[model samples]
Target: MPITGTTRVFLIAGDPVAQVRAPEIYNHLFERHGIDAVLVPVKVPPARLADFVRNAFGAENVGGMWVTIPHKAAMMALMDRCDPVAQLAGAVNAVRRADDGAIEGALFDGIGFVKGLDHFGIPLEGRRVLVIGAGGGGQAVAAALALRGVGELAIYNRSTDRAADLCARLAAASGGVTKVAASPDPAGYDLIVNCTSQGLKQDDPLPFDPKRVDAGAAVEDIIMTREPTPLLKACAELGISAHAGFEMLVQQIPEYLRFFGMPELARTLQDDTSEVRALLYPK
Candidate 1:
């Protein structure tokens, strides 16, 4: 429902809010749909997220929020209830404020990435997927894929313990089909998903040797800013199909809109891709 007075406000909150593209993309969508809504970025320190959300809830215009980075796990504690994916992933990346002022949280990154893969016409069912980095993002992606009935999932992290824990969790959830293991062998896998922060900075070594990557496999990097991270560039040179983080960003918005009780607006806005691309990949 639209707000009674003025505009409905949405926010994406994280430590480093200046770099976020959500406001641009979402505001454009709001404009296109003729909704009295505006999306903004909010910079909240890790310790202040709970307070911020509490205060924001009192404001009648505030509708929803997007949480990112270090806060995805922390934000779950502030919500009234979490969606199934958020509960399983142990994190929340989006939150919606209901008419009663209750907050509902959900994790969209994993599902969004799979939606991106689908957008590119890539199939995950029965395909062997190699996921590097067993961090929050990796765990979310692995769980999402397993839920989609992927044939095999091999997860690797620098810390073997983390990988083992994540693997065990996924295996239990997947009914023993998802396999978690160490090593960057890209061979025999249909998809390679990078969920680490390694590519966010320059001069970072390739997480794994590019030569070992299967030439026929598709590569997906969750880092959004740099279009061609070293790993993606390597995959490209080797004739591999690759997807960047923008695809995930684009795929996530619709789910977020629905969580905020605006499914029609979400569907209407998603029909246009040019505006989203322009916001995400501004020159």
Candidate 2:
């Protein structure tokens, strides 16, 4: 919708905000749905995050904000209330103000990832899954898969301690359903997800051997790139199905809208959003 003085604002805040495409995708949705809201990217450095949260989010017309990159975990400390999912994941990627004026938070990264896989006809129920990287995104995916009833989960990180910590946290939260990967080998798992930044650079090493990825297993890279990440390309060459990271971002749109109290946009968004999706794969 055209921004008026009364237009509600939603912010996607990160230090390096130029690379974020959330404003494009969400602003398109808002305009198409005729909602009087706008989503904008804000470059808020880590040190100033707490003050920004206190001042900006308290605005009467501010709907909510999406947190990204180094801010996801930090936002958790800033929220007055949190959804159970965010609590278990140890992070919050989005937040909205409550009726009582409290900032309520939710973690949607894993939810989006699972929905993206479902869109591709990949089911997690009873599947053995391996997630590489135990950072915020990795932890969120692991927690979501466990709650979705995946039969087994293996978490692997360069830091064994971080992976092990995520395992223990998930196991405790999910009643003993998660474990640290014995090895990074991915031979037999039904699903392997790369949640790390391994594929961002051309010379970046593969997180794991593509040969070890079974042809029967599906591989997903969580790095949003214009071209196929190295891991995805390797998986395709090996006859393993692969998916891009933005699949998760796209699939999470409805959830984010709902959290922002704009369920109307979720339903009214144009079915053909190819142009918007293309912008996500920036050159």
Writing each residue's lDDT as its tens digit, candidate 1 over 48-98 gives: 888998788788778888887778989988899987678767789988876
Q: What is the TM-score of each candidate against the true structure?
A: 0.90, 0.92
TM-score of 1: 0.90
Give per-candidate clash totals: 0, 1
For each candidate, the alpha-carbon lDDT, in order, equals 0.81, 0.84
Name the TM-score of candidate 2: 0.92
Error of 2 at 208 (Å): 1.2
Worst window of 10 by summed lDDT in candidate 2 = 267-276
Which predicted model would earn the best TM-score?
2
Q: Give the alpha carbon lDDT tens digit for every residue of 1-283 in model 2.
A: 5689999988999999988878877786677667888998999999999999878965899888999988999999989989877887889999888999888899998888888888899988889999999887798888788788788889999889999888887886665768888777898799999989999986789989989887678888888777788888888788888898887877677788888887656544325435445645545
Deviation (Å) of 192 in candidate 1? 1.2
